[model samples]
Target: MAGASVKVAVRVRPFNSRETSKESKCIIQMSGNTTTIINPKAPKETKSFNFDYSYWSHTSVSQNYFKKDIKMK
Candidate 1:
């Protein structure tokens, strides 16, 4: 079980290992270890929505924003 007010991030660096030399990445924003991955398959620098999650969280609140368990609903 996980705490209701906890926010843990699980990141997976999946290797292409195929013809494509690009090493892909996968990021997941887990809520209480629930593993609700938003972009489990996204091209990091090439993706347009990369800033959709991290950007808003950083720009919208202070470092202590988690003090209230705040999230973009």
Candidate 2:
């Protein structure tokens, strides 16, 4: 690990069969190295977190995109 620190990378995936069938909604949003999660029960409530890396594979899955952003010391 870089800097001997724990690196957290959040990757959201496409809904699976069950979720698709149930029409589940995604409450997660990512921008830069920040991730915001919405409360399902309360729309007004949300929590944001910062991490070493955040991969938004849910929208676009490109190996090059991931490789380009991720770094190793």
Candidate 3:
């Protein structure tokens, strides 16, 4: 059998109640299979990475449902 590449993903969750109360902001964004993270203190300095999948679930229900269907080796 041929060697296969390992699949990877990035999951970004929104701030919870406590964070919201503190006025925290999200500096991450996902586009297709690419995820970009921006420095909160230095907005101009950003970094990006690519993954097989990206999940942006702001709620527990959505995140739990997505996790249930994922199969890991």
RMSD to truth, every model:
11.9, 6.2, 6.7
Candidate numbers, best TM-score first, in rank order: 2, 3, 1
Assess every candidate by TM-score. Answer: 0.21, 0.70, 0.69
- Which pairs, if any, clash in model 2? none
Q: Which stretches of candidate 1 lie over 4 Å from their true place?
A: 1-20, 39-73
Report the Cα lDDT for residue 45, model 3.
97
Best model number under TM-score: 2
lDDT of 3 at 55: 80
Which is the leading candidate under lDDT? Answer: 3
Model 1: lDDT equals: 0.33
Residue-level lDDT of model 3, residues 1-73, one tens digit each, is 5997899877776778999999887777666677778898899999989888778675453433233433222
User: What lDDT does each candidate get?
Assistant: 0.33, 0.68, 0.68
Ranked by lDDT, top first = 3, 2, 1
Q: Model 3: residues >4 Å from true position, as ranges? A: 59-73
| Tens digit per residue, CA lDDT, model 1, 1-73 | 6756654433323335662366443343323223334445452423222222221232223432122332244
